[model samples]
Target: MKKLLFGAAPLSSRAADVTWLLFRLHLGLSIAIGAGWSKLVNLTTATEAEKMVGGAGSPPDWFVQQVADLGFTLPSAYFWAVLAVWGEFAGGLLVALGLGTRLAAFQLAVQFLVIAFFWYDKPEPLLGMYYQQLLFWAFVLVTGVGGGRYSADYWIWKRATARLNPPAARAATLPAIPVAG
Candidate 1:
């Protein structure tokens, strides 16, 4: 019974590890290709974005004017738009590579926040902003978990530790042999 249980344990653990790797790959690809790609491809114009933010409507105009009235310089609408696009672009690439996931997620989160802030008057324009936040937080969570089990980080760490401890490496490489009386 013990042998059976022990034999199954490693397989179960390996399956879980593979699942985690798949999750990271899915998340990274979605962020890089689905979300980031769209932004990067459409960063040049802001006419549509400005209209969505209520810039042409009385409610958004009043909101913008109120901020401007307070002596705060209203940011050029395009500035915020471009910032979001580039932040998601670069951050998503970094996260996809597993090189700097935390920093990339942080930048993406901030970009979402900025977009949310500017478009608060037009909830329709900010409909999917929270989803971006959720994705960013998910990335942050995975970053804290240290790049999952089958990552470049794991491979590099294993190689470095093996190089630093040759005796341990040699012991690990030796095959087990059964001794008979």
Candidate 2:
């Protein structure tokens, strides 16, 4: 790999962590533009289903009818649509900020899964599909672990751990207690 890259050095864990953080930050910011920001700007009504989907070509009337025929609740449908859109927006924001990364990434991952698998006619077949797949995997990573050292999750974890477990130096400074027989 290094030979093919014109004497480039292998990336270290620190570099990888930085790269991961940057990758999520950039992707989250970009996704937010359309997925998050657009929906937010247009959001006025709590039950506005049409606003969830941007541009033209919302699901056909026949499809809606079919869903209804299958006993799909109208309010539930709208509620989910609005939820997904807001989730995308909120997820992107949280991921970018490295706050609530796991939850945000999980939500985004589910959103992409629905789009890539349910929405796409052929799953993982095209470059676009591959992009979504990669993004999904990346989100999964963030979900499973987190945004790494650069994230708020990391800071919170470190603080919590420090509070839970004192440093050796600090522990050594404490007076020894006599044990009760």
Candidate 3:
């Protein structure tokens, strides 16, 4: 007989479910603090936008310098600044809300990778922001199991599924339409 793993099924299920709930909340909040909050604050201030590019732009000096490092100038840098802020702020909000966790995580991960390779190029072992990015990347990669019971993603999925394949009784309640000639 195969050994029954995880001791008991029900206990294991509850444990997993609780763990997912906590994980989703913590990870989502972390993302919000890391990016969303700053972007949100920046949104309220004109100078913050200028500060972004360190030249009357919202991009940070380093961010703008990176653009110049790659020979991109002016409006391109500004555009990229906007993209970065949105990637962080909007993506973070969605992840925190569990409204589009996977998409947000993926977008953030891509942005981090680009920053790591082109913007900072941190030394081996990766400390500071690089380390944080690494953790965020790993978390998203390891926990790509949609969303938990406490997540909006879960409810949305359930609702969509019910709508797509409703029960027979529910379906029967619909009024018959007239046939076209």
Candidate 4:
């Protein structure tokens, strides 16, 4: 389980690792703050607004209706709506922190792909689909490459391994010195 969580594939160079870091940061922040935060805030705040105007705050009614229109029907629609909203907000945060990079990236990739193919409509759907497709591919890249060396997963893995074999255990395995007779 630990290995599954922390065993990120090694990068060939420091530059590559840095690039992954930057990409993860931007992608995570964009989803978390730009897309999900307002909806999340509205859900939590329980505002009396009829619909989410200008993308500021989305009341339950509006969000549920949108999810239902997307083919999820009522009751189940509410569950799926909340799931997608949390997936964007919290999953983005986890990706940004590099705590669970692969899992979070995969989730985001699935969510974005769905949005790209299903969410947009006949009016200029091409543009919206193109934009979402880019995000989907970016997330797929992260899922393949993982969090890299500078990620939280690496730091935690390093600490855990160090604890498993302390200095005393290492010294015990060292070769003994021979004294001249």
Best by lDDT: 4
Ranking of all predicted structures according to lDDT, beginning with the best and ending with the worst: 4, 2, 3, 1
Tell me the lDDT of candidate 1: 0.53
State each model's CA lDDT, in order: 0.53, 0.66, 0.59, 0.80
Clashing pairs in 3: 49-57, 49-58, 50-56, 50-57, 52-57, 52-58, 52-59, 52-60, 53-59
Clashing pairs in 1: none
Specify the poorest-scoring 10-residue window by lDDT in model 2. Answer: 1-10
Name the regions of candidate 2 deviating beyond 4 angstroms: 1-12, 43-73, 120-128, 168-170, 173-181
lDDT per residue as tens, model 2, 46-132: 566676576532333443443344355886665555566667777898888777777788889987776665654456555667777
Clashes of each: 0, 0, 9, 0
* Per-candidate TM-score against the hidden true structure: 0.53, 0.65, 0.63, 0.77
User: Residues 1-181, candidate 4, lDDT per residue (tens digit)?
Assistant: 7866775654899998888888889899889866677576664443635434444433356777888988876989988888888888888887888888888889999998888877756524456578788998989988887788888988887788889999999999999999999
Which candidate would rank higher by lDDT, 3 or 4?
4
Candidate 3 Cα outliers beyond 4 Å, as residue runs: 1-12, 39-62, 66-71, 121-130, 169-181
Residue-by-residue lDDT tens digits, candidate 3, 65-87: 66666556867876776677667
- Which 10 successive residues of model 1 have the least lDDT summed? 2-11
Candidate 3: 10-residue stretch with minimal lDDT: 1-10
